[model samples]
Target: MNIRQDDPAAPHVSGLLAFHLEELRGVMGEHAFALDASGLSSPDVTFWTAWREDELAGFAALKHLGAGLGEVKSMRAAPSARGSGVGRALMDHVIAEARQRGYRELYLETGTAPLHEPAIGLYRRSGFVNCAAFADYQPSPHNQFMVLAL
Candidate 1:
């Protein structure tokens, strides 16, 4: 798979971004934290798309949180790409980028719902450990926070 920094607003990414947001909202309702295209396009965020030849396989983003800190955001593998290592590849790419940017810690917030189990497992396997809420997030039963010290 080839991974490259990408624009969320590009035609190639719009459909997947819409689907990702819709699915997250369907699963978590108001508690969903996945960003929309506008959010991912913020100046502090760097987005990437994973491609298998001409097909878009997945996407993920890293948000600079200032002071050597970074947050993982908008990680989603296409339905057709799930279970084929796309998620792992995206996670690895984001982590490597965080390290390269001199971040001392990488953080992420995900849901506690069953729909999130696979992602939580992936995060754990990638070295993230449970942590208290960070940044602007409030502690809640619906939210699970994790961090990896770089």
Candidate 2:
């Protein structure tokens, strides 16, 4: 899969954020989405979608934490694309871009649910270690944090 910057007009990005907005809320509830630590709307944040052939498979975003740290945001793979390595491809793309841009480490906060284990595992196998929440995030019973060196 290939990763590309999100284009608001693209069928992928056009509705993708709206979809994740709802899903994220469902996963973490209203309080967390309001934080937007995910930075989905920040102009400085980078949104990328994975594409294979002519189809968009999944999406991920990187949010700058302003201390050589980065956060993973909006990581989701299409139902048909799950378990097919689409999520990993998106993650690898973001990690490579982060390294290229000199980010010293990457971090993320995800829901503590069985549905999230695969994503957590993906990060673990990619070299990330469990960590306390970074940036402005406070500890949450619903969320788990992780970090990785660049």
Candidate 3:
């Protein structure tokens, strides 16, 4: 598997993103949480994609929030890519990019669900711990917040 920075609008990036959202709807029973794929397509955001044998597996984006802070958006792997380290690979790439860019911290909002447990574990293992909400997101029973200090 290979993970690197890329344009979020690339055909593979878009497909992984849609696949991620569709899976979210299935797990959350609705489109409760959405990754702003459009924002990822912006030039202001730093995006990354993970590939395995040239197949699009997952992608992540860092939306610059100024003052060495960034929000991790649109980090997800296709269903077939889950549990195969694609998510971790993408996250590691994004987090490292954040630190390299001199960000003090990285934050994210994910779902709170039995199905989301694996993702929760992934974040924690990557040095993220529970944190208060950041950016425009507010406290909601459906969302879980975490941050990692670089």
Each candidate's TM vs. the true structure? 0.98, 0.86, 0.88
Model 2 scores worst on lDDT over the 10 consecutive residues at 30-39
Top candidate by TM-score: 1
Of the two candidates 1 and 3, the one with more favorable TM-score, higher being better, is: 1
How does each model score on lDDT?
0.95, 0.76, 0.81
Candidate 2 residue runs with Cα over 4 Å from true position: 8-10, 34-41
Candidate 1: tens digits of C-alpha lDDT, residues 34-82:
8888899999999999999999999999999999999999999998999
Task: At residue 65, give the lDDT of candidate 2.
Answer: 78
Task: Tell me the tens digit of each residue's lDDT in model 3 across 49-146.
Answer: 87788788777788898899988887878778889999888888888889899999999888897878998999999999999988877777778899
Cα RMSD of all models vs. native, in order, equals: 0.7, 2.6, 2.0
TM-score of 2: 0.86
- lDDT (Cα, 0-100) at 82 in candidate 3: 86
| Cα displacement (Å) at residue 50, model 1 | 0.2
**Superposition error at 52 for model 3 (Å):** 1.1
